[model samples]
Target: MIWNLSICFMSFIFLFLTSIFLMFLGVVFIFYDLCYFIEWELLMLNSSSIVMTLIFDWMSLIFMGFVLFISSLIILYSDEYMHGDFNIDRFIILVLMFVLSMMFLIISPNLISILLGWDGLGLVSYCLVIYYQNVKSYNAGMLTALSNRVGDVALLMAIAWMLNFGSWNYIYYVSVFNDSFEMRVIGMLVLLAAMTKSAQVPFSSWLPAAMAAPTPVSALVHSSTLVTAGVYLLIRFNSIICDNCLGQFLLLFSGLTMFMAGLGANFEYDLKKIIALSTLSQLGLMMSILSMGYAKLAYFHLLTHALFKALLFMCAGSIIHNMKNSQDIRYMGNLVLHMPLTSICFNVSNLALCGMPFLAGFYSKDLILEVVSLSYLNMFSFFLYFFSTGLTVCYSLRLVYYSMTGDFNCLSFHPLHDEGWIMLGGMLILMVMAVFGGSLLSWILFPSPIIISLPMSLKLLALFVSLIGGFLGYELSKFSLSYDLQSLRYYLTVSFLGSMWFMPMISTYGVNYYPLIVGLKYYKVFDQGWSEDFGGQKIYNSSVEYSQYMQWWQDNDLKIYLISFMFWIIILFMFMVI
Candidate 1:
């Protein structure tokens, strides 16, 4: 306990101090349009300069401050949550490593340096996910690691492609190489990397799977830092990606991811997975807006979402801790009666997630929706945005109804205590931010108000979705009491939504099944049969046959050797005659 406290104290001090410094930089950059750019020529490879550059513009500074701030708070929370665990030190170390990698990713403009941070996040997150050393944790860790590796591989390819530009400093080429074929390839590769890191579309399975990690890890990693890295990267590379065909594809897929995750969350039973899906939905929101050429707005939402989403995870952590590790919302009921503080925190975060009028999430989400509303979009993108917004409300209210309002449904007595200062401390800090972060950020980010002209119907669209979703969420959770919707007609629809539209299956077995079958055939044919039969066994048989032939040289009689030599000569002569 003492060691954990000491580490948390030290981390808090360091992160707070650094956050202040970065905030100062952000302010200066905002006012003066100044960037603190530093470059070091690390080495030269094939006369192509491999340099590391750090760019501290307002965006980087502010985002870094937000990440470090949330990380420090999460560390404080972990002290209580991970108490009595022998691997607590390892947990703290991994969390710090994640933060360090995020910082590395945030400041560096060079693709090579960013990979160092990018791969660091993947490796450390895998370690953290399986920190409990359970089978579920192991599986989750493998999925998380492998899914992110696709991004890592994409990043490596992007780096290799960027080598044609003579420097790995991609920010320099973001504007100038907009039309180059190599740059287009690099842009597409970077987008792929971002999609995986952000858990957009097909790579979305790993985000929910990764909830097997400790809650503090989830609060910091999935909710805030690791997941947002992709959106941040795109914001940096927006110059090259915003006008391309790939952007349209990204727009389409990201919208689908948002809707899919929101719909899936409505059917999800596990509390942590529900929150994880919410994170995925929000990630999709950010990516979709970015695809539509609103990078700053996407980044703004990323920051606000981090603030409240981290609190949401912490509140879920508190509830999970109080419920004796029960993460199933079906097993929880009327938590507000027992854990009032946690309930409040959870409610605030959820409302923020739903983009309640004045909360942190509202500023960014509303701006995103307005921008999206005004943009030139087809019906597909339009439906995805509006309907996904409703689904967000549907799931948020469903979670509230299941866990906060019904009777306490636990099988055993579990005392819910709100006096864990370490736990509540983090929640309280973020709750305040979740309450006020939107207004604060809006004031800072947009000194000039953004003006949008929309029809009254379109302006009320978000409100309509929220109201309808809330009503449906309440009604649906109580549907079993009054309806027989579980009949054969509805079974497939329920199963599909309940199974997250089989995304997990598609991302997992659907992707790996054929490759695995092919591997098995290779094992059977080459590894087991052909390789041994032709490779090793054939060599051995040939050697044996040579040995048998050479046995003629060891014949007991000189006459035998003379006969053999005569036979060999006769064969040679026959060949010559032919």
Candidate 2:
């Protein structure tokens, strides 16, 4: 017992030290990149000698910095939030494990290492989700694990297919698979995995369930780590996907997920769940950009989203913590007055999420919209973007309004204050990034001196649509619009018809459905008759019959064994002669 305790203590110390070390390394790397940004040759030469070549890229650096920054903040936040709580040590260990896995993931050279890191993250996240050991938390963790498993299987199949085709390395895979039919299939499979991981479309139900985790875990995993894996995957394989039908499919699916999830966020009341759904929506937008072959825009969105979303989630956590575990936004109001610093940080991040002009999200989102406009695809994508942007505005404002603007009704038992200097320190850093990350990144990547301009007409249109959506949502909230809408019914009907229309094609080319049908029929038969009817009859009938048979077999056992041995000897001799 003493040895085990010592080992645990040592692990905690190691993690705490590593967190600080990586954070320092990350800041230094960022500064290094910034200095080298002015001279491309120097940057390239320096990168060549770096221990991890994969982490040398500007995109990797950006994401790594975000990861380190937020993770360090989370560690500090956990110190206060989890103080004196049972399992605090274990929680810190898991947090360290999660951060280490993400760092490895950011710098992994190939798919194998990436998968290891990815799966490690999934495991740690599951642990954190069920850290409290409550039934609800357990169920949520199970569902998340199952969903991630499906994605993992898809990823494994894609990796195997790539290796079989002699494209094992990341760069080689992209170059070789650009024009191959097998590559297209592999890309689609990867996209499926990405979709599930990012909580897109029909696979999105697990994200809200994941809210059962502790607030810090929710903030860290949902925003900066787990959900972003799919976006990272999409960005990593953008070249191969862009050259295939998978790109178009991704565009459609991503746009659809964004629109749908934004709507869901608009309707959700749980603060953490709202942020969870928003993460899904924002990730969908990022994926759509990647699908369009705009790798720079996608990475920019990833960086900016990480900053703003993490801040927003952490701020939400502070509010919930102050409210004594109440996450319902209805119970929260006038927090702007009570927690002034937090309110500013939260509102700034919220505006950034709303794509307000000159903020981080605006730059990234506008770039994507611009690229989408230039794409040769159908107009449906454009329409989806327009509608999604409006919905994004509505949900983003919903968060601000419900938590910061409404009347203060809930009585405070304890005086509310902003979280400690350590937590606020993290939020302040993110706030700075939320203000400037996009502009700095764009300057680094875009060749020639590109002017940073927020077009007045575009701003006006976005703001007008946003205000309309927000106002409408506010008005609608006054009434319980609980009745099922005809539009939703139509959506379901069309979706069913679409599935039916594709069934014949799937049956002919995809996996065989005959065996599945047969198995279902057999299961129904057994469930209805054999098990049910036999259980209702004498329960000992089969046992008695089997016992009698066993006694008869025992009487003849010696004779049977002798005959079987003789038959085996003769067969063995015959086979040898042949």
Candidate 3:
């Protein structure tokens, strides 16, 4: 008990202090737009400057505060949740490192400095994901690491390409960069980096697979910090990206990602995995909206979603802990009767996730839908946004029905007390935010409410989607439940949704298959066969033959030397006569 509690207690105190300091910074930056660059000119070439630079601005300070606040709560929650673990200290260290890496990412305005935080995030997250000594954790860590490395490579390329500008600092150039070809390339690469980090579209498989990590990692990684890194990059680069053709493509793909994740959540049965997919879906929402030239709104949603979603993960974690690590929803039901507080927190977060009235998600989500409705978007994007909204409601309700209501589904009963106040303590604070954070942020972010001129029918569209989705979710899960979903007629459709439209296969095998085969072929042909036969083996045989000939000539050294000398003399005399 002391082992676990002491780490959490110390971490919470440090983080709490850090959060307060960052909050003070955020307030200062917000009022004054604090912008400064500390430059160390290590070396200067004829036309370029290489320097270490750090930027302080409202975005960095505010984001840093939010990150510290959430991280502190998560660390505190892990005291009870991670109790009795053999390597709890290692977990605590990784979590703190995760927080530090994120702070680096938030503060840097230079691409080179950003990579420091970016790569740290990838490496630390991979370590945390594989913290458990299990095959599943190992595979998940590899997938997570490799998927993120694609982004790291992209960022490095962007950094190299940005050398044309002679400065690593990009904040100054964002407004005008879109006019140049090189900058456009950087923008596209930046978008790619963000997509992989946020698990947008084809890169989405790793987010759910990452659920193999401990839930505290999931709360921080998925809900707020790691996944949001890409969105933050896009938010910073919005000026350049929003004007590019790639931004339009981002809109299309992000919509697809949102719809895909929402649909996948509906078919998913694993409780933690379902919530992981929900996080993926919301990431799509943020990215797609950012692509539509609403970067601030997207950022606003990012903040509120982080609050509620972290709480959501904590609630789910508590349930899993109480259930002795059974994540299958089929084994859960009527949890509210036993774990009332957790159930309340879970329901509140779920409602907020669905954008229910006055909740944290409602503020940002409702605004997004309204603004998206008024924006001049294509049909595909419009449909995806609205339909995906409903799917969010559908999955939230389905999760509620299967796991929070109905009879006790588990074969054996355990004490369902919300006895872990250490875990619940963190959740309680987040719950307050989940209930009111949206309204508070909305007031601060948008001093005056945004007004949209839409017809009555269009204004009600969001409400309609939520109602229909909620009803369908309840009916399908309760009254009209059928076990024949695996019948011949329904099997294919069920399998498609169940498998997340086969995205896992496409992402895992589709991306890796050809490269792996090419690697094997190279190994066989060059390393084992052709290189040895034509290069090393041939050279060795020639050397052996020459050595043998030299040995034989040496055996008859006097005669051989005399004959060779006479032939050379005759040739030289003939040439002189000619």
lDDT of each: 0.88, 0.74, 0.89
TM-score of model 2 relative to the true fold? 0.77
Q: Write the per-residue lDDT of candidate 1 for residues 1-578, one digit (tens) a residue.
A: 67767887788778867877887778678878887889788898898875678988999999988888888888888888888787777777888888999999999988989999999999999999998889999989999999999999999999989878888877876799899999999999999999999999888889999999889899997666889999999999998888789889999999989988988888789999999998989999999889888888998899899999999999998888878888999889999999999999999999999999999999899889888888899999999998999989998999999999979898585576774987888789899999998898888888887799999998989889889988898888886533258776455566677667788888888889989999999999999899989898899999999998778666666788888889999999999999
TM-score of 1: 0.91
After aligning candidate 3 to the native by TM-score, how far in Å is the CA of 470 from where it should be?
A: 0.7
Ranking by lDDT: 3, 1, 2
lDDT of 2 by residue, 126-233 (tens): 999998889989978987887788888987888888776654446445665568777777777778888888877667767778888888888887667888888887
TM-score for predicted model 3 compared with the true structure: 0.89
Say which candidate scores most in lDDT.
3
Measured with C-alpha atoms, the lDDT of residue 109 in candidate 3 is 85
For model 3, how does the per-residue alpha-carbon lDDT over 369-420 read when each residue is reduced to its tens digit? 9999999988889999999999999989999999889887875765777857
**What is the TM-score ranking, best to worst?**
1, 3, 2
Q: Per-residue error at 455 for model 2, in Å?
A: 9.8
Residue 340's lDDT within candidate 3 is: 96
Off by over 4 Å in 3: 1-4, 32-34, 38-50, 479-491, 513-578
What's the TM-score of every candidate structure? 0.91, 0.77, 0.89
